[model samples]
Target: MKAYIAIKYHINLENKELIEEISNALEVNKIKSCCIIRDKEEWGRKTFSVEELMSISFKEIEISDFIVVDLSEKGVGLGIEAGYAYAKGIPIITIAKEGKDISNTLKGISKKIYTYEESSDLVNYFKRLKETSIIHNSI
Candidate 1:
């Protein structure tokens, strides 16, 4: 089973590296992502667009078995995606940077939030999430 990962793209040049680093981690782990990129028709920042696109993305994500989120930046969009996935009855896997705090909206998620200090941490967390999702679907 595949998973859709929601991540925030930091607009700052310095933080853009952070976005790419995190996105690469998702690809390396083979978790499908809900990241939005440049397009003439697309307006607003990547994370900001989540509020507008959550329902649409949720339909695509629901095609898969689970949803994983990167809440390192604590963007509102990640929260929107997480909530949508939760409401859709899909299991949620949250990945947060080691020093970051899980937002109030995401704090109460029943499943454990995998915390990562580096890209490697993200990779390992995704592996665990994938295996758990596979087992969950089998039952």
Candidate 2:
């Protein structure tokens, strides 16, 4: 299965370890992830217009089986991505830090919402889901 990772672009750069942890968890479950920031080289180093970026993101979402959105920090792009995925009938899984407040709209559209104290908690949750075949069945 493949998952589209939706996160605030700035946060992605600042929280590399957290992103890496999530990416590793998906990898462990054999789920490929597509995230623009990490895959920018594939699109070349040139700057893209906002429309160009959204076009690319929509295409990525089109091919993905599901979306995993990090709501640790809010961003308009994250909501747009989640909404687009939802409209496309792609499953959405949301994750946030333990104390973060998740938007009700986001929660309503998500198949699952996970809150973690540490990145490892996200890893273990994925591991558990894999063992139970929940990930396979859900998405």
Candidate 3:
């Protein structure tokens, strides 16, 4: 199934390397994924108001089949995307650091959340999830 990768994209990810790791995971899974900054230009704000952002975000989530989200860093936008996916009846795979408080808004929805302590673990998680899904469906 196609998956949309939702992450905190407003920040410069060049230094983080986590985004690249996640991108590779998505591609290796042969899953179609789009980053949150899909249309944004570098080095400046995109000039969108809150309502407009939500509208576009909701639209994208509706078009996508499932959400694979990175909540390694907390952000209001990521929370919104998580909520949007849940409300739209899309399956969710969320990754967050261990011990971080999942916002109440996100917890309200039952998601198959995972935690990754390292980048390698993140890749492993993707591989395992995909394999498990294949097995589950063949039953």
Highest-TM-score candidate: 2
TM-score of each: 0.69, 0.89, 0.76
- Estimate candidate 3's alpha-carbon lDDT, on a 0 to 1 scale: 0.68
2-116 per-residue lDDT for model 1 (tens digits): 5665776444544555555665666787754544532211323434444446556766667756676777776677777788777777877777778888876686863667777
Instruction: Point out where model 2 deviates above 4 Å.
Output: 41-46
Question: How do all the candidates rank in terms of lDDT, highest first?
Answer: 2, 3, 1
Q: What is the C-alpha lDDT of each candidate?
A: 0.63, 0.84, 0.68
Counted clashes in each candidate structure:
0, 0, 0
**Top-lDDT structure, candidate number:** 2
Candidate 2 per-residue lDDT, tens place, 1-139, comes to 8989998766226766677788888887788999887785343455678889899999999999889999998999999999999999898999999999999999999988999998877767877766877666766
Candidate 3 at 63: error in angstroms? 1.8
Candidate 3: minimum summed lDDT over ten consecutive residues — where?
Answer: 38-47
Off by over 4 Å in 1: 10-16, 38-52, 131-139
Instruction: Kindly report which residue pairs in candidate 3 clash with one another.
Output: none
Candidate 1 — worst ten consecutive residues by lDDT sum? Answer: 37-46
Per residue, candidate 3 scores C-alpha lDDT tens digits across 1-91 of 5667777765455423676677677778676666556543222346466677677778778877778777777777777788778877787
Of the candidates numbered 1 and 2, which has the greater TM-score value? Answer: 2
